[model samples]
Target: MGVLGIFKKGLTKTRNFFSESFTKIAAGTGHFDDDMLDEFEETLVRADCGLPASSDIIDTVKASIRKTGNDSREAVMDVVRKRMLEILGDKTSFELEEGKLNILLMVGVNGTGKTTTAGKLAARYKKAGKKVIMAAADTFRAAAVEQLKSWGERTSTAVIAHPEGADPAAVVYDAVQAAKARKADLLIVDTAGRLHNKKNLMDELAKINRVINREAPDANIHSLLIIDATTGQNAVLQAQSFAEVAELDYIGITKLDGSAKGGVAIAVAYNSKLPIILAGLGESVEDLVDFDPIDFVNSLIE
Candidate 1:
């Protein structure tokens, strides 16, 4: 399916919630009064849009209503849609450069689908005819290396790994050398999720980055911070902590299908000012898609 179709289908839960709540709020008059607007702002917060974003959007809606002298639901919703789009920033897609070793360093807290996302990306790049390799750099976590190796098996991609408790930077150094020797186009490194100790995690990432720089200085790299939409505002806070240390280039939002908290995307964007490069709309490998700002906002708030 096309990107628009994918977004529409994946955003079913959020769209349904939006429809139901707005229908209830606009029941008789089909227009918003002060009381209706107050309740609607609460609804946005409930949808996990975050306080700052919801407040900003509602302020925009109120100003538009005052300027147009139209309190109709159509007018209000249009204002909301446009404001949301603005909050998401410009539209962009994820793409690899030709004849370069592109590295996607997946980082996030535990249970945010970090390794699964790395596997899906390997599958996707391999299907696109790119030479892809997976690096199981999450050596500290139990079973993390095995899980990434399994993904490598499923995708027919080779995985470079070390024994658990091995230095993660050593894994990165070997992965970089292997990619160069094999002339691979992409290398996906799945790192451990240990946010409970931010300083240690940051130090580990720094060491791995040093290895990559020393080993493959010419490679194109993107540090992708994964966020679970199901976690709502908590995900936003976690992302902020990562932003302070990870030098993140993009965010990959996962688990959007499991809840109506899809507005977490908006919250993340507002807080981080970073582009969301990927969306995990479902459990299937094929369900992962590039985050299209226009399509996402249309499917969500309409």
Candidate 2:
């Protein structure tokens, strides 16, 4: 399916929720009065768009209604859609450097689909005919390492991993060397998904980063935070915590198929100012697709 088709299918629940609520508002008193605006803002917040983003969108809608003197539902919703697009900004594509090794560090809290995203990414790059290597650096969880190994097998990509409880930095160091020796184009590292507030875990992530920087100084590095869209506002909180310790270049939102709170994507983008590079629409490796902001907003609001 195309990007819009994929998003429409993946965001079915969110679209239904938004469309139903909006239909009610349009059927209401049919005026963009203060009470109506308050209701609209509440709907946005209930959709997990975050208070700040919902308020900004409502304010923009109010201004547009007053300026244009068109309080029609279509006009107000057009303003709403425009404001949402503004919050999402532009679509940024993820690319690997041709000559140098590109390393993607995947980080998030446990059960946020971090390992799964790494596996899917490895599969994607492998399909693109790039020599890809995966580093099972999440030594804190034996299951995570095993999962990544399974993905490597499925994707026909080599994985560099160590025994459980090994230093993650050591795993990354060895993976860097292996990528160099094999002349791999991309090396995707899977890090432990620890609570963002854990000081030791954050420090360990910093150490792994140092290892990558020192071992492969010429490699292009991208830190991506995996977020579960089902978690709603809590996903935004996770982004905030990870942004404190790591230089997060992009976000990868997962589990959109299971949640009606896809608006959290806008919340995270508006609050963190980080582009969402990828989204996991379903469980299959092929379900992981590039994030197109216009496609996303259209799917959510249409």
Candidate 3:
């Protein structure tokens, strides 16, 4: 299937919810009336669009109706689509530097698929013919290093890790040396996700950044915040929190296929102002794809 098709399949639950719910709102009248507008707003919120975004969207559509005096279903939907695109901004893809070492720092609370995404990213970079190495810097979590090793094994990429309780920055130090020694093109680092103590987490990430900068000053670094879509509006909160904690370059939304809360993506982009560069559509390694705003909006709304 093509890229848009992949988004459609991944967002099946969300797409179906919007489709059926919107049709029900019309309910044989063939278009939305004032009475149906509240119900329409509820549909967006039910899909986890968040109250603020849903309100803005519905209010915009309502304004369009007032101005054009055309409340046809198609006209309303067109307005909805345009407003969503404005919220998402322009779609972006993950890009790598050709002549420099590119580092992807994966950050998020546990169970947000940060580690798995690290592995999947390594696989993608390797497929692109770049020599990729992974660093299991999430030493605080039990079995985190081992999980990364398994992905390294699966992807035929080298992983640098330390025992549990080891200093994560030390692991990054070693990983950078290995990347340099191996002349690798990309280094994907999986860091600890301990948001319970914000100061400690911030300190740990700072230390990791210091190591990377000292060890590979010329490397291009991209800190990606991985978010679980099923978490609903909490995902937006996480994005806001992480932006304060780290220099987040992009967002990677995971678990979109399993949740009807795909609207969380729009909510996140609207609130965070961080472009979503990756999406975890399914469980497989290959299920991770670049976030395409136009295609994503179409798949979810149409």
Candidate 4:
């Protein structure tokens, strides 16, 4: 399918939620007034805009209406759209820098498809003539390491994994060194999908990062937080918490093919200020696509 066609499916679902909420708030016939503003604010907050951002958007819309005296529904919507984009900030584009090897660390809670997405990413880069190696850093789960190994065999890419309960950081350290020695094009680190005992999450991720940086200081290391699109507002909370722990550079939102309220993608991005780098639409290896903002916005409105 075409890019627009693929993205439209997701955008349509997200827009439906916002549009329905906005419709309820929109007046039958009146200039932008206090009641309309209150309604709009309520709608935004319900859509997972968060308190601060929701307030900012409402304020901007009110200011625009006051300045232009154009309080029609379309006018209000136009202002909302502009304010939304502005709140989203400069849309980020994620591309592996042209170089020998690019290392990416994938992290998230369980059931977020973290390992599956890593496998899919490796296959894509390998197909593009890049040597891809996956490091199963998720030592906490017995099945996670095995799952990544299965993906490695399927893609014909090498997977370096230690025993279950092994030190996750050591696995990453070894993987980085091996990738450098083998002249691999990319080293994808698959982290554990659990956040049990808060201290473990903070210490484990920090140690893993330190090990990788120590081995390959200049390696194009990118940390991606995988989030389940089906989680709705809860996904936003996960992003916020992960951002506090891991300095995440991008987001990989999965399960969009099944999620009815994909507005969580926008909520995550707006609240955390992290760019969404990839989206998973289906089970195929090619189901994941890079983030496209215009296509995303068009999908919502059209």
Candidate 5:
């Protein structure tokens, strides 16, 4: 399936949100009155679009409606789409670059689907004819190694792991060495998800970075923080904590399919200024997809 097909699981909630909002506004009978505006603001907030974003959207639509003397709900919806596009900007995704070993350091809080995402990403690269290997460096998590190994079996990619409670940095060091020996094109390093302690997170991530630089100086490691879309504004806090410690290049919002707060994608993009490279729509291997901003926002409206 294509990107949208993979993401369609999340589109239902988005559809219900906008559809309900559109109905409420239409019930106002072409009036840009206070009640309508309040409902609109509430809808945005409930959808996980943050306060500043929702207010800005409301004000812009109201201005356009006033200027044009068109108080139709359809006009407001059009303005909402335009505002979403503006927030999305012109960011094309950063796909796996060829010819060099692409390292994706997956980071996220517990249960945000980081491990599964790594496995899916490995499968994606393998399907694209690249040699892909995964480092199960999340040594602190009890089942992390076993989980990644299972995924490796499912995807038919090689997995590297050390014993439990071993230094994750050491696992990554070994994985990098293996990747070089095997001439692998992609090496995905998985890390443990501890509480958002700046010193601890930074120190651990620094160790991994140091190891990668020492072992494979030419490898480009992209720090991608995975945020759970269901958390809504809380995701902004998580993203901030992760970015403060590491030079996060991109974000992967997972479990969009199960979240009414799918609008967290917009809130996160607006707040973090980090491109959302991918979203997880299902548990299947093909469910992970590149985040298409236009298609995503349009799906919410449609």
Candidate 6:
């Protein structure tokens, strides 16, 4: 499917919720009045845009209505889309420069699809004709290594892994060496998904990052926090917690198809000030697509 199709399909739940609420509000007084704005704000909050973002969106809408003296539903929605785009920002594209080892460190809590995202990312890079390697650094989990290895096999990418109970940093260290030796374009590291409160695990991630910096100083490193869209506001909390420990460069939201709270994407971007690089619309590797703010907002509110 095309990018728009993917967005439409993936955001079905969110679209339905937003559309229904917006239709009801628009159906009611054709004017962007106080009551209409109140309902619109409530809809945004209900869709998991978070309190702050919802308020900001409503304020923007009210300002637009006042400035232009136009309160039609279509005009108000156009203003809403513009505000959302501002919140989402324009840095949606994720690029891997040529001739540099691009290292993406995947971090998040368990059950957030960290491992799967790592694999899918590896596949994506490989399909783009880049030499890719995956590091199974989540040794704390019993089957983490095997699961990553499975993804490696599926994508025909190399996986660097150590035995269970091994130091996760050591796995990353090995992967860095492997990338250097193979002259790979990208090295995706899969770290154990530890709760944000776990100091030891967070420290381990730091250690791995230090290793990457020391071993591959020329590499372009990015720490991406993977989140589940269904978690709603909790996703924002996860981003905040990870931000305290890691230099999160981007966010990758998963399970967009499973929740009506995809508005959490906007909340996360606005609150964290981190660009959403990609979103997992479905289970397939190809389903992981780069985020497009215009397309996302249109899917949600159109």
Which regions in candidate 4 have their CA more than 4 angstroms from the true location? 23-27, 30-32
10-65, model 5: which lDDT tens digit per residue? 66887687777767675747656767877888888889888878888888888897
lDDT of 4 at 267: 76
Candidate 5 collision pairs:
none
Clashing pairs for model 2 are none
In model 5, the runs with Cα more than 4 Å from the true position are none
lDDT score, candidate 3: 0.91
Models, CA RMSD each: 1.2, 1.1, 1.1, 2.2, 1.6, 1.2
Instruction: Give per-residue CA lDDT, model 2, range 70-150, as digits (tens).
Output: 998878888888899889888997799899899999999888998888889988998889999999999987888899999
Q: What is the lDDT of residue 121 in candidate 3?
A: 88
lDDT of 1 at 212: 91
Model 3: runs farther than 4 Å from truth? none
Query: Against the true structure, candidate 4 has what lDDT?
Result: 0.80
lDDT string, candidate 6, 1-302, tens digits: 89889989999999999998888886857767788889899999999999999999889888888888999998998888999999999956668888889898899988888988888888888887999999998898768889999999999999998999999888898899999999999999998877745798778888998999999998989889999999999999999988887888999999998999999999999899999989898788888888888889989977
Model 1 clash tally, residue pairs: 0
Which ranges in model 6 have alpha carbons more than 4 Å from their true place? Answer: none
Model 3 C-alpha lDDT per residue in residues 252-298, reported as the tens digit of each score: 99999899999999899889988998989887789888998899998
What is the overall TM-score of model 4 with all chains considered together?
0.90
Count of steric clashes across candidates, in order: 0, 0, 0, 0, 0, 0
Against the true structure, whose lDDT is highest? 3
- In the range 270-299, model 4's lDDT, one tens digit per residue, is 788888878888777778887776666555
C-alpha local distance difference test of each model: 0.90, 0.90, 0.91, 0.80, 0.85, 0.90
